[model samples]
Target: MDEYDFLGDVAVAGSVDSFDRAITPFLSQAFHAKSLLAIHFHRTRLPKVLFRWIPDKTLRQLFDKRYEKLGFMVDPFFHRAFLVQDWEACLLRDIAPDRFESSEYFTNYFGDTNMVDELGFVARIDNDTAVHLSMGRNQGQRRFRTNDVVRFGQFAKILAPKLRQILINQPADDVVEAQPLDRRFHAMAQARHTNISIREAEVAALIVQGHSSRAIGLKLGISGLTVKVHRRTLYKKLSISSQNELFGLLVNYVGADA
Candidate 1:
């Protein structure tokens, strides 16, 4: 079928599941992506994996075991996409931090994925929720060109309204609520270390949440230097040196708590 026919069908899809099934085939064909993931973000809660279409068994297993569990915490694209309030699409590289490729998150989780590139669509569904649709190309494949990003943007404009409708019709209870970050960290820090201070724990929590030192300072009403000081102290107390290590520790703590 042509793009017009497929989009028309998607527009009239009766359910989110049906819309997803219809669109996945079209997207896979258009982008040459072997894996697709749709993640729903809720306010102050763990993001839900709304849908995943991965053809390779090994890749699926790795995603479920690692990426689904901990990698999201450190994903620059995941964090940046959610922060976006508008409906838009972009390549992961476009949204990633300047030094993202050299970061530990890249070295630890993303590097192992063997995926050459990722493109994402970010759509805000409500006041406190949004969804991100990611397309990944397998290793050794040529990266998406400029034209691909443009085409994906057009597709996103068509998909966003339909997805918003589907998500709006779901029961409110479908979204799980998580405990406050500070409370969770307080308990975890107490159980893990005796030398870490409350301020240091707060810094660590923000770091794991994907906030830069400047952002953390703004949120806490402190100077950037103070935030850095807290971060350095926290790193020393945790015996970790990089944000990647801090992310690993938080993920492990959260996983253990679960």
Candidate 2:
């Protein structure tokens, strides 16, 4: 494909089928993405499936039904999407925390996807609305390169605004706020140790969700050093020596629900 050939067809894509025909070549040729999933997100409700394709049936069910139903509580990507409503392409590794790969969210659910890497392209619709296109690479496929992200991001920038418009013109669905994810930490900690402060629990939750102290601080309006202080205090209160222990406790406490 020439430099201008990729995503050029999207300009005439008026429907999802047309869009797929236009983008499939670029995805397979440029990024080698094995799966492409588009999700609509707003507030606390489960992410609405705009369009999704996963080759394996079990993997698709695990992600769409099971993960969205239960596993989202600990998903770093889900939390980050709502927190920032970032409208750009980002690598999953860059968004996830220092120890996210070790958490149950990674080991149990995300692991099932069998993806070597994930690249996300988000389109901001409004203050609390956005759409995310999640692209994945399987074990045999090459990971997305820098040029892939750059080119896809440029295409998404032109295409995302249309998603915004489509959403605006559509009738709004009823939205019910789900349980606040922050409280899960407090609930889990109090089951064993009652001394954990709310702030400490919040930090612990973010930590287990793969956030760095700096990322947690930015989310909580505190300094990174303060987050570290809270980490030490929380660890002490929970009688834990490391993040691995903390992740273990949360996984145990959150259990089948997660």
Candidate 3:
């Protein structure tokens, strides 16, 4: 009957490693299971541990002998799995006669799975990355129960927003190509001379979306203080202070067609 809430901690875990450590104790408490494992990624190569449930005595031996020794390239799948763009990529494949398995990923990473039955959400972290989570009960009486699955599913939802932030809210890397603005956001920035960086434009659009500094920070994988700084800079660049004044200042540029 543990009643601890892992929602806040998981959100604060940020990166994969941090998330792994943060969720360990929480998972232990919530699921009351013997073992757990969490794999996180940042592209197609950097598959790092987010957390794990290793009950074996020789953890090193298990990793070295099983994954590396077997030559299974788990890293590729871990790093490349993104939910939004690759919704059709996640699948389930049993490794041992309906025992252990994974949520198989698609060429692009998003997809469905036969691994566990539960509710979940997927989101794009960037143009090339995403993440996913699903919860299910172990039918075996000695292992887990339906209540455990229900509890974990609730916990997982708490992390969804944070996961979205981690995967999607990152500051735009100059290396990645900027996404073409959608009609609304595009119209808002129509007169930015088409030379503004995507990061700047995204911030501008968020501002128009009526997102507060703190809200934008959570959505974009940045600190609220950083959002404030960006807002100030944006004001200076656009020659306005109040968001109320923004539409008027940029109306000439964005509303020109109208």
Of 1 and 3, the candidate ranking higher by lDDT: 1
| TM-scores for all predictions | 0.84, 0.75, 0.39
Per-residue lDDT for 235 in model 2? 86
Question: Model 2, 47-106: lDDT tens per residue?
Answer: 677677677776787777655554666755565666565467788887777768876567
Report the alpha-carbon TM-score of model 2 versus the true structure: 0.75
Question: In model 3, which runs have C-alpha deviations exceeding 4 angstroms?
Answer: 1-5, 11-18, 42-46, 58-60, 64-124, 132-145, 167-258
Lowest-sum lDDT 10-residue window in model 2:
67-76
lDDT of 1 by residue, 108-200 (tens): 656677777899787887667887888999887889999999898888887876777787887755545565455556666677864677777
Which candidate leads the pack in lDDT? 1
Model 3 over residues 1-258: C-alpha lDDT tens digits? 233445556757666557656666666555544445543334433233334555544543444343321112222233224434533222223111121122121111112211122223333556655555432223232434456545555665566556556645445333322222223344455465433345666666556434567766887899989888877876776666776565344434433533
- Better model by TM-score: candidate 2 vs candidate 3: 2
Better of 1 and 2 by TM-score: 1
